[model samples]
Target chain A: MGLETSKDPFLTRVKQSEKDTFMQKSVAKAQDAQWDKREAARKELGHWQDWRNLGEQIRQHVIKYLPDYLEEFADNVEKRGGHVYFAKKDTDAVNYITNLAKEKHVQRVVKSKSMVTTEIDLDKALLKIPGMNLMETDLAEFILQEDDWDEPTHIVFPTLHKNRDQIREVFQKLGYEGDNDPTHMARFAREYLRRDFLQADMGITGCNFAIADSGLINLVTNEGNADLTMAIPKTQVVVMGMERLVPSLKEAEVLDNMLSRSAVGQKLTSYCSFSGEQVAGESDGPEDLHVVILDNGRSNALGTPFESVLQCIRCGACLNVCPIYRHIGGHGYGSIYPGPIGAVLSPVLDGYEKFGDLPFASSLCGACTETCPVKIPLHRLLIKHREVMMDKLKTDKAFNKAIMKGIGMGTGDPALFQMAMEFDHSATLPFVSKKPTSVENLYNHEGHITHAPSMAKGWTDVRDAPRPPKHTENFRRWYKDHEAQKGETTDGE
Target chain B: MKVVVFSTCVVDLFFPNVGAAMVEVLERFGCETAMPKKQICCGQPTFNSGYVADSQKTMRNEVDALLSVDADYIVGPSGSCVNMLHEFRMHLADDPEYGPKAEQLASKSYEFTQFLYRVLHVIDAGAELDAKATFHRSCHMTRLLGERVAPFVLLDHVKGLQMIPLPHIENCCGFGGLFSVKEPEISKLMVNEKVDDVVSTGADILIGADQTCLMNIGGRFSRRNLPIKVMHIAEVLNSNVDMSRVRYANEEELAAMAGGRD
Candidate 1:
């Protein structure tokens, strides 16, 4: 249930999510709520596109000089007396941290929510260690943990599919008694996690941005749980995707501003901090700091057309505007990254065979690209992914390819297409009906095709397709008559 | 000036009145207009579906057809298809010949309102429309084609038309051509919400520049038996007929609607 959720195929996943009315309603409502707030937050900075350009420029620079930045960032981290482990594979990352925990005789482990952790299945890996207790401190993460690890539905708001009552039910099983009010649930969860924070032997957190010049990691949260995750533990491990590096604090701050605004439409999250290993005099920071930089197929995207996916700040702005995501929810994508970014990034990470279908899920409405703060041409990338799947990676699409080729041949020739158009009416007219009638076991009824065969059934299943016109000759005739009448009348005038 | 009008497939077959209106409007604006019989679909059906190599045929054919005509401007009633035509250069970037031809066509091609306002600089075509309308800014037109202001500029000078902002008007109408069929559930929900916004505006007519979207929204409207009339802005602009009455969707009423801006 990590990257590949169901393995039930793409359309099946879409069907399952479509049937979840509650999930559909919640996502729609969330998208509607996020619209104005994102706009207002973006508007707070005058000439927001300038900020986007700056953001894009900064990310583009970092990704282009990634190795250099990584060298400088790792050097600075070690200079600050921190350990840097550049993990080329997820297994390397998992083994390094699990081995460290074993070496320290770690008993109780706590973690702040991290998508990278989910990507590498670090939780599952850690749980493999016997005689160790682990907990997810982020409230949503904790709830999911308690529910036996229900997958996250969004990047920023992970438990988007869960309602307050469902949460109350999850918490009630942990010896809680309260109404479905969020405040009460937060208070109870705070007390519950506060006790664990005290006993937490090792704290692991996700890095939102890693400032390369200073070797510092930045984390943003509303509950300040990440601050606690860093402060309370003697041993802290920060897991970050390799692409999360910013050249310096100036660029980091710029992206931080954009990320906050784009992620949750906030001026700033309640807690935004830059932390490194324990400073010489610092009493509260982690005595032993480990920064695990996980490549995990990111370098695969480095020189490709998908290089801009590395530009993603994980703002999830694309998700809020995506129409398909609204109906199918995050689970439909079957990847930790969902929406426009996921459609582009997942195939880049996992290859096109499994994740190729994700790209086609989008309508290519350009909404995602328009709202992107970093100015990623998300819609175009989606198309590019489709191109790679169709032309390069995929071998089983010959039928679809043949069909498209045939269409191309038809449309490329005006005479052929016009002839096809002429005969299409009689071909389709057999299936069309004037109204839903008693004597019908067929494709159409009531001036619409209610049911259709083959791939066309996809549409008819949801909405009725309009019938083709009975006569096509009248338009050309009308054009001729109109031209003649206009010629005659204007000549007289 | 001579104008070659590309009546998009939706216009050529389904809604000829809209095409007729566009030609009449351009003609009345003192431009001689003609529709070439050789033109066909924009190949978006294949191109957008990730068949760019195959869709190239339609793209090449389109470039050939439009380039065959010698006109001051090549205009079309569809923002989406015109945007597609403008995209031919990018698609045919490898062609030594068609690449330059694509650039030339894209430069000369414009959506109808775009040519009217940007090139002709004619905001008012001396046409009067007596209807209260809320414009659905189709995604391709406003966002992709960057013709956000031209349609509104033209609508502003109509003799007797009242316009109000649609709530979250930038949201898409779920009519991504093939998307309507490929992901019908989401498409249905999206268009339904778009219709809700149109209904919320309380405008009698829902006007847009693209017929694909108009048809999608209008189809849903008719299916639901909603009382709103869907129209192309070209038809509205082409009308010089005297109005017996004008419909209204006032600022106060707009504000009264749920989710309205102050």
Candidate 2:
């Protein structure tokens, strides 16, 4: 998956998705199930707001002192006989992991669900080394792997947009002989993955939260894949975003609760494994352990307005709640992280030249922020991204120039604003299908007329652009005219 | 009680009757209502479109217009506008004076039903209208303002009115202001869903607090030529207009009604 998906006109994708009634129905049903489960879980948790507040506090505290905690975490990991490598960028991360794989002469690697791995394109990176084989151990991820390395639509579900039939087709393509039933498919995949898990030379997993004090990497999974991936493999490698660190086990517990509830509406996942450095006399664990803490532009966010974005736990709750994500689905985001978090993070990690349009994808409804477990202020970050895109980077130069002119004119002169309004009101006449108030007129105008010069193509390409009323008779003007006709003085303080 | 009216740009322009109705309703509740003369737009259109600087201009204009008023409360019939006032105050963070002014403006502003129920403590205005109506809970109001209870409280008490609750009332009617025009197909899909919910209610009329939303739903109602009358809740409550004998028709009736010019 590439950032070009977001560059595709939103209208085209929306129309395509709308046409896919089957996919739409599946999405709607899944959304309903997830929403109900989430509601019930919130109610069961009792004082869900308190939980959210605690989650936010823990994340905030962690982000606030990330550097210190990271150092402490590294120290603890070293003390426990684990090696820690801090990578400032994707190259650094890939090089570190590849070196480890080469040093161990790792022939086969089994991986659990790790978005960070995808972010760095680690699988592709690792495949460059001769005689290296990477296998996805998660059932959904394995399906993705089997399906010619299809990008995940959602961070948590991975293949959520794919129906059971689609999964069956993928399984069939992979030469699986099993009942098309979901349970059977799952069981078949499980039996297949269990063998790979047992024989894998290395286990690579994403850390949900790395506890600073004890040097523990917390991994939450509904499938016992992570446990198996770590258990049987001779060498283990954990890759985590640097921000995925907590001060202690107490914070880890809070985050674990938040992550489970937010991701899949569970009190806790089936497997909540906390692994530290390789210990002596440990029988069922990897002999060598390497923790790669990848910065990957996250360090740039610290002390910025978007610092809160670092607080995201990759729970994918924001994706589940986003209206845009629900409609176009996550593949449209063209990133490992999709939906609201992806919209904010993609442009920051990647340059806006590629993902500038991502920020504009949202309606800024604040739903993501409202539902966010760590209170990342997802919408605010979207806005901040726009600000930076427009003012600082000037990624969309033509659009920004036009908007700046609009800003100047809109703010500089009330007369100019009124004039523009007047022009707009009158301009509606040509495109007006029935009357000014008619939906047909609005839709027609929206589709036909290009209102704002730059980026009008971006908007008008998708939907009817409603013309703003150009009448100078604003509320104030109307009120003045009415009072003048009545010869009555206005009452005010 | 002194109440400042933030006649949202939509009501002030296309649907002036809604504003007139708001004035009458508030007056009946003993509110000394005053429309601030300098207020223009709520800045939401610019703000939501990622034109923060342009939105701030509009916001600054709005703040300048309303800050002088010392009303007990500022009330608007538009949930979107009220929500913008309350929620977008943070955008003014860079401007110290205007930032606090925006917050102060937000604090005084309430969606009409919220002001009526919370501020005026008037559940039933003791006024009556005869119509079977379903309420469309504007998403911004319900989710952003958290004013879910106020509209129900006020509507429950309207004498001679049969209130049928709309199914999926929380779903947006897709009048996301410029969103309807910008993303017409998706907007149509959303509004179509809303219309289905409205039609399923089997009510003769669809009532909402925001004129922009009502206009969007109303336009769809008209386009489809559904026999559903879309009216602002303010118009429904304040009208005292008996609809028992009114026979609804297609283009002819609408033309006649427009010609009658009441």
Candidate 3:
């Protein structure tokens, strides 16, 4: 589906999400459960903040020296008899991976969950090569693969928005004969994926954090599908975002702990598999291991205001706590990523022209900032995006101009400020009604209206436009008259 | 002590009696109140919307107006604006010229109940009110200003008032200035939830520190023909206004005494 086909603009999605009672109930229940579990998990772990601070410091150090880290990471992997490829862009990344599949003449590719691959649309790219059957091993990704053109709702749990009934429908459509029970569903998916794992020529997975010191790529998952994919296949390719690395295994251990707690409130996931090149003594592992470090616009963020965005461990903790995402869900964001981190990262990675509206979608309530384990300052970064969009990029001309004018009038002179205040209530009175039209005029042809205007049509498509107050008694004037009548002295200071 | 009342634009236009009640309540606590004529807005509408530059102009004007008054403290019926005043001081931190002015504004300004409890140290004002009431904790006051206990402290003292607990009291009433109109459906949903909470309390009146929330919730009540009354915290505290002489009930009482009551 085209991005703009929704027609209801960005704010409308928020309104729609707000009114989604089903989604709200699900989100509220999930949040309560997750928060309780998270609290307990944090208390259990002890000194979570200190650990988070260390994780943040490590990530920051890595990002600051990203060039050096990337080189060190690739060198270490190569030294361990693993092939390494650096893809500067999406096309380059796809080209390198596709050429590898072509050279291998791979018939079937079993894939684990990898957002970097999704970012490059690598599955679609792989399909272009003849007879390349790409099967998603992750349960959520598998459901998305079966559903026609459906995107993931969340990074961690891509199918979190979908309930069991929806999953049952997807399974039924995919010709699965099983009960809708979660255990039965898992059994059916497992039985079905086990066959594909056996037949697959190459396995592709995402690296959570490539440890430079150990020359090993770590994959964390609950299902152990990544391990199965890597072990059963003849060749394995790990496509990772360049920033996803730790200098040593010690830092990886710290990060894995933080990631588990923040992502899904787990003490640890079911599997944390580390594999590089298969050793001679190893009984089960991919013989040819190729680690693809994809740097698609991430290099640009280094030393920039958005450097903290790279520290994200894909925990989805920020998304879980986001009020805006709670309502709009993920699909509304029109990207592979969604929620608070997506609101910042999408615009940076995808450019402001396509996703600039994402930053303004938030109320800047700072919930994301408070909940962020790595302390990314998600809300402040969003504001910084707005500043860049309005001042530096000047993407939306009319909106920026209006905002600038509004700011100017508000901050200019005391007399102007007083006069505007005196007139504001009266000026907006025409549209002040219990039932007004979707759009209404504030003044004759001046365009200061009650309804959402053309550029702001996104906001009004789903919300009731507020009717400004229909009275002219500015508080200052009322106070003056009341004080004068009370025989109070006018100028005390 | 001389107290300057920042009556807030919402109360001055849409709900004037909130200002009147504030004055009355302040006098009962033995404080003289004044309203500066040059005051406009705390510039939250622009500031929260990412128009910090524009909001700064209004902030400077507000600082100048409040500074002109030689009052002991600046008290406002709206916690949102007072919170904005505190937020604005931090925003002006880099400027050496406005740094002291921002500090002065921050030190002097207080939300009404906060001023009553913290500044006046009035544990009980010895007022009498006979009705069941539930307090709606405004998000700005609870989360931003951290003034959760002050309102309850004063409300607990009302002679005959039965205070009921409102469910989900900490949730935003969905009256975020631009947020209400900008996303009305969700805004309505949030407010509806708040209304449900108030109705569940079985209280005769719903009280809040901010007029913006009261206006949104109160308007919904009026539109839906809900019987529960909505009042600012100041109006609840200044509940000495006798309703016995008025034959009108249900908004008619309010309309009859509208301009003259204050």
Top-scoring candidate (DockQ): 1
Task: Summarize candidate 1's per-residue lDDT along A1-493 as a digit string, tens digits.
Answer: 4566668888788878878889988998899999989999989877898999999999999999999999999999999989999999888999999999999999899899899999989898888788888999999999999998998989988999999999999999998998999999999999999988999989999999999999999999988999999999999999999999999999988999999999999989999999988887887889889999999999999898889999999999999998878878999998989888998998888887779788888778899999999999999999888777666655535766666677678777877766665665566666564664221111121265557665566665554455544444434445777899989999999
Candidate 1 chain A: worst-modelled 10 consecutive residues by lDDT: A437-446
DockQ of each: 0.35, 0.17, 0.17
lDDT of 3 by residue, B2-67 (tens): 998887655654455677778877876678887776677787766665566656677888788877
Q: What's model 1's lDDT at B28?
A: 69
lDDT of 3: 0.75
Residue A17 C-alpha lDDT in model 2: 68
- What docking class should model 2 receive? incorrect
Q: List model 2 lDDT by residue over A215-260, tens digit each.
A: 9889999998998887888789999999999998888898898788
All candidates: TM-score of chain A: 0.94, 0.88, 0.87
Docking tier of model 1: it is: acceptable
Error of 2 at B157 (Å): 2.6
lDDT of 1 by residue, B47-123 (tens): 88777777877887788888787988999998889999988878888899999999999888999988877666664
- TM values, all candidates: 0.91, 0.87, 0.83
Give the native contact fraction of candidate 2. 0.09
- Candidate 2 TM-score to native: 0.87
